[model samples]
Target: MPSNSGRRRAGADRSPEPRRKPFWRRALRAIFVWGFALALLGAIFLGSAVYMTARELPTFADLKSSQNGQMIVVRARDGTELVSLGPSYGRWMPYGQIPQVMKDAMVSVEDRRFRQHFGVDPIGMVRSVMVRVETGRWKQGGSTITQQLARTIFLNNNRTFGRKVREGVLALALESKFSKDQILELYLNKVYFGGGAYGIDAASRKFFGHPAAGLSTPEAAIIAGLVKAPSNYSPTADVKAAIARGEVVLGVMAENGVIDPSEAAAIDLSTVKIAKEGNQNSVRYFTDWALPQLDLLLPETSEPLEVWTTLDVGMQQTATSAVKANVPGGAQGALVSMDRDGAVLAMVGGTDYVNSNYNRATNAVRQPGSAWKLFVYLAALEAGYKPDDKVHDEPVTIEGWSPHNSGGTFAGEIDVRSAFAYSKNTVAASLGNEVGFGTVAAMARRFGITTPITTVPSMVLGTSDVRLIDMTRAFAAVSAGGTSIEPYGIVKVETTGGKLLYQHRSTRGQVLVPPHVAAGITDLLQSAVAIGTGRAAQIGRPVAGKTGTTTSNKDGWFLGFSSGITTGVWMGRDDAKAVPGLQGGRAPAQAFAAFMRYAVKNRPVEKFDTELKLPEWQLEPDDEYMMGNPDDYYYVDENGNMIEPGTADGAARTGPASGPPRYEDGSEGPGTAGAPPPAASEDFLDRATGRGNQPDPGLRAAPRPGTAGPASGQRPPTVTRPPTVTRGQAAPVASRPSAAAGAPN
Candidate 1:
């Protein structure tokens, strides 16, 4: 073989002679492969960037101002606004208003390396990775202060891969354009503290009732800790938890030299002081009025906007004070006061708006017990019945039921005026039966008592449920001479800078009885205040109203109206549990009295004009039109016996009370002289004692359809003569008359 150099030269010559491939061709092939791979990666990156940046852009307001927000003042009058601040300012605060110490604490706790590495802290990422490796768990995060700031200001609002990449990019861009301080300031001012607070300033004020700059070291630490979780570690919630979190923050601050160990230890950890029950909002009750107004004013899905209510702060305070003082202990209370035009002036839904959102004035629906009688009386008046109309006060039964007075004793006889002032259940029920339940329900709707009026005999006795505001407005209608106007809270909704976004125009109309008829009812209602169930609500002012107390005392309500103010009050438990021994004449009446005493203290006391002052309730001969016992109100036509409408009621046809029959068996019976009623129902032994297959009328087969005989008679069941064989009750069914003939109880 040749030498190495000689062999290479000979090999080169031989290869060239054999038509060697072109150098550019191989280079082009390699370049093409590299370009293809790089292009593929570039496309992937471009697609990712485009997708991330293309997320739907939010409107200017949608992100910054959407909230279930309303402005309200519990008290207001004449067009003047008292508690003016409502939903506005993006977060209810400005950046300059924030405290420096709070900002410092946040910086120390959230991102200590905020000053270094642009937006994304490189050191933090490295440290987190190291910790994760050392701890064998992913317990740390790589997000920098700038990333969090971007999330607060504007970001994907999501936790997806695309959002994360975009967040990273935005953070880097922000750091490039803005200083670390600017981003940090923005974060501090824009973050939410949850309970309706958007920034540190608002959070501090809402929790401590003071500016954030006023916070002490421990307070600042607690606030800083709240940055991670507001509602959870709120000092107002769990004091121990808040202190524990504050201590953790103090440790961090000490570790970072933000504070010395001695200084940290000196910090007081005496928890944040809130209202104890709930957030202290000035326009609490006005919220009840404004919310409905907003729904009507705003479009179904309009841009975010704030609703400024026309609530007077002083009035609201007075109303709350009144409720607090007059409401029975262990009983929840609510009050509503409005101006002549139905503008809400003062309201206290409950003891605290923050702890409970029940909104008794607006949302609570309790039985209007006797107050419901107002509508029935109004119906009767509208149907040509007079206040002096003679009504019966004797035992009478409906289809199968009968009503009794509150004291379980008849008044012997009385007129509509006397019956109304006393809130007689039997009298009110009689009025309902006469006017018809449907008519009463319809009339109630006109006065803003829009809830359904159930169909039942006792329903006429005010067994219907109605809200405080609704009842208040209904009574307000009576005060306004039957002009029904819907209650309103917001006079107009405006922007933070005073731009009028919406202006409400509320008008009153007539939905039921004429104004004159309403006047008659008003006369009696005023009498109730003078001397009746509503005596507690008497303000020495000429006013008209009704007092309501439900069975078992579940609710107490007083709806009354004066010349300048129309108010309603309710007292009960949040759980709807019956308040032992509480009635409308007590707590609710007292609450109404207190509110009216303060609210109308400076107003004039005016007298109302009564349509009819005649005492036409003179003793009249028996007639069918009389209220209670038809026989007492009606008589025969002349000839031995004859009648038209009188016969329609079988009770009136029954002859004079027949003395107990002279039994051939000489056995005693019920209703006999000096003897009590047959012990059939009272004595369980009569039912339990086995008297050898004696036919227990209760056990007798129920009536078959269409046939009418003593056996299986076509009559309904009842309380006094309930089927003993069935369950729950025992009575001598054999001697009991048909339930359809009359009410058992």
Candidate 2:
């Protein structure tokens, strides 16, 4: 409001007196701003210098494509390649060769400023900082393609200011070192797509089974979105979220003018491409077990290598489905399958490998129970007892220790066929004693029983321990006719360039049983499936198997074989706790049944062994072999003829209609011996009557062989004529036990 004249005077007066904010003040501000800018620029330059140099550090392999430019072909046993893995070069092209749709998709999803920035966008950093500042926390990165490439090829895993600075410097260096096109090409080719895949090419092939260059609009968008966070965009690991991310990326590409708005709108984001196959076909257990066995030959320690194994992808699928169907829910189990020569064809450790770490097939060692009877009976057969031979069901004791049948009862008397077919515990126990605990133990060892065994009489009852892998291999020995072989997983390893570096094949050795004997045993095991405890395992084709259930029903196991494959299954609680009333004939046998059902479904059905037969036996009881009080019945006779009618101390040896033989001639015959004269010694009578170790009054001669076994699924009880028995002594039975209701028939 004062006048212009006054204002002019005031201005003139001020101008002349002061340059108060003189040279020093102005100079300070200029220096401060320029100094800060120079320092920032300098820091970036120093970091870029350090990072670009890091690329030449030979550190590329760490994050580079595994198999490093190589492709691994997983082949089935029959030489069928199941999968081919490598870069998807055809489906994926450099950023230049990509369709505008793909470019837009990538630009929209990753960094809209990708085209304008000098390898990075400071704007992105500032925005990221703003976001973090608003949230009062830092949770994001502002990495550009160049920065990612530098990190991929050189940097260790660290998230810090120094690392980011280095990243920017390296990005700029890379831009200087290579053309933008080349840098983009490498970046597209080097990004990881989660699931052990690297580069768009590999990822495309892994996800789509095609080259990346051929990617469709939606596919391109999805893959482009993955560039932002490959794992986050993984459809295999998570599909809904991945698809949502792709849509957002397409929008960005349209906004950035990388693609036409209409094209961006047409890009599909409703669904994502899914993996054609799971990495291991869901048979994690078998694969894991096979992994260690691979070291047997490849020795990963010797050199970096791969081994080509004989796994059949189809068979693996079969095994996985079978496990899920057969093994009880909330229950865990393991299955191991192998070829006759011990080449592991398929293995599955548990129902859901992603959720379970327990490997019931190999890691868990549970009792095989009646399954152990196979070994017991085999030992008997090896000891010269025929499958049809007779064995006493009378009470027997080994060092005052009595072994009871699984159901805690005796069959009174039976032949080996009845004993095995019915899974009678008493006869098995008797055969175990006769075969000698050493014999059964030896047989198990030859078949690769890794667990230690005690020579307790119970060993005759299959009390030893074994793993599923070893059990399958041992059972395979039976199928292969006595050739013991090792199981292996890896088959051959080659460089991505096709240079063979390692290979593995099974090694075989002749074990204890003869081929014929093994074949014979297999024949009986087939009966076990067809007419015995393993009835559930009787597949459409010929199968031989044995089922075992542990005491208290804690564990269940089944071992069986077809012409081409042998498998073992174990079911139990992880903590070694009882599973209530679970038994071998339940879960394990069922799993075996389920596995064979599919394993043989699409494959050729073959007979177990074309050349095996059950042999006949003739029984003759051995009195000396009686389990208790060996001297209660036999003594020297006056005539030294060992007469049945003779007695000790000049008294006649006899019982009331117990046996009726007072032969003047030494000819042999069978039946209830006609009661002989009473033995002179009432002491023998007292011993017989006291505990009545004497044969049960209910004991009687059984019908002859041809008359008995054919009636029931079981063999006849045996009653054999003893060798010149005086009053009390009988010789060991010959060949096999006789079939009879109460005697060797």
Candidate 3:
């Protein structure tokens, strides 16, 4: 103001020294200038990031199509819908059709300032930051409903700062492009709920068996609660947890004034009825088993697929009923049924699928007991041994291990067929020794026993753990005339648009065993079911199978085939505890019969390719005769008189020795008196085959059945033979008893 010249010098001096600016004012000016410049730079950076992010956003049309696409649908062989996998969408509910209460509940619980915010809520963001700072953990999210929609549509749920920035820009763009109602509608239709359901309508129908338009307030609260964690809060997963979360949502609604506090308090959540399809229906086991195969058969694609499986609903129900009806309480059971071509027809994983989802049929691995003899005997047959080949059934010890028969008394000597029929442990062990353990393991591998098999003596006694499916598949191969087959549940896979992804075609199977070998194996199985330990499995029509009881009765198995279906049953405690009365011949055999009777009811009766001609032999002999005392092997008559062999009275005595004789006068035995009750013949036969003190070091605990065994390239332990010892001082007597017990018909 005082500038001009010398004249101004005086004026300037008089002008209060040019009115010197205050320090505070100067500092304020500098701060404002720098802040403006920094803000402009920040705006430019933010603008550049937004531009880059916008380019990555999907077109609106793409979003709409993705929301409308269906998930994979699985159907049974009869075109019955089994299950829907992946993100399953229901018919879209329009914005107007969405319930007001549902909207209010979501807004109140997820974001209270949803209406006031443009894309992000500043107040909510500050609150969330403060809470995180105070608690050192994220307690609240600052995202508005539009922001959530943006993230769902265009961004993954990543927590990186870059992702957050992208989410914010997309949210702003969405807010500018669409109305609040449209944003909410998209969110409701696109959000995922548990159990493969997407969108509010599908969630409502899946959880409550109704449409979203019909949702009650409590149901709306429950569905709103699912947004945070769909799986954890899903009603099907835990109804109590879902209801508790719903109560939280109700409380939030009340605090936000979206609902009357009294009304929120009075809401009856106890009456919620979850859909039964999610809880019951054991056929889900089959669906679960078959779902993974889709990945193997087809290329990955986002389009929804339609899968047709080999499941027979009728057979599945029958098998389920049979397993439930016969399995003893406190013990679990599993069953698998397949056709000759390895098409899995029915599978029951556990006694109650609702209580437990473990698929025992394909997953659980347990010792097969005598059921493993199938491989041993098959190896014997492959080694040129006939059904009538002589095998000693006496107490024979190998490498310090002595295997005993079920009653602890050997049958002395019998044909391979008779030994198999009676499930003689010594005979199986001897056969395993005769045909090398490696050969036995190779035979098992060839027949689809993919589990680790240590070439040890006990493996022949079913000591090697195996899955029920593998055993059933092996039996199926035999039923298919020795053709190798890989069990398959999926029949075909196609897109909903009818584009074929995969189709199962019946190819000529590799001949695993010669047809005559299978026929011979069938002959042995027939004799087993006809008069052997598996007699409980006999149906009127011809059937073949084997009975297996593991060590300590920990597992019981019955693998059999009738007509064209092969079924295997396994019963045991999951913890490997012995059930006193559990045996392959009792529960498992009975269950097999119950299922097969219905499984084969409609199929025409078909005889086995080979006739059942079992060798004539008695399974039990008198103690004296077994002890090498043929001269003293006499039968006592009704009058207490000794009868010689071939006598008229002795003709009736052709059957096995009942026991030590009881005289007409009530006296005890043939020996003078008090022969110490003659060491009561071992009455029960459920003993393990190889009884020894040495455990195989190479045998690790068997892995879960369906999983891989040892690490790749690992070799099984080498087989070492031990010295053999015979039990009695008297040599084994190969004499055939005069008794002519008829062969199995």
Model 1 CA lDDT for position 683: 35
Backbone clash total, candidate 2: 58
Q: What is the C-alpha RMSD of each candidate to the true structure, in Å?
A: 16.9, 18.7, 13.6
Query: Which prediction has more favorable lDDT, 1 or 3?
Result: 3
The clash numbers for all candidates, in the given order, read 15, 58, 2
Specify the highest-TM-score model's number: 3
lDDT of each: 0.63, 0.61, 0.75
**Candidate 2, overall lDDT?**
0.61
lDDT of 1 by residue, 56-174 (tens): 43333343453434443322445444443343223343446566667678888888888867777778889888999999986677787788866766664576988877787767666
Q: Candidate 3 on 1-745: residue-level lDDT in tens?
A: 5546977677767744467799999999999999999999998987776666656656655666675334888888999988777776778888899999999999899988888888888999999999999999998989888888887776788799998887888887776666788888888989877777889998998899988999989999999999999978989877888999999999999999989999999987878888765625778788778888777888878788999999987778778876776677789999999988888999999988867888999999999988998999888766555564456666677555778765576544456676787777888787777767899999999999989998877788888889999999899898888888789999998889999989999887899876556877888898787766776676668999998887777888899999999999999999999887777877788778777777787789898877665433234311101221111223233332334435644343355423223221123454336321221122211111111222221112233334544344332232122224444432222222111211111
Worst 10 residues of 2 by lDDT: 621-630
Over all chains combined, what TM-score does candidate 2 have?
0.53
User: Using TM-score as the measure, what is the rank order of every candidate, best first?
Assistant: 3, 1, 2
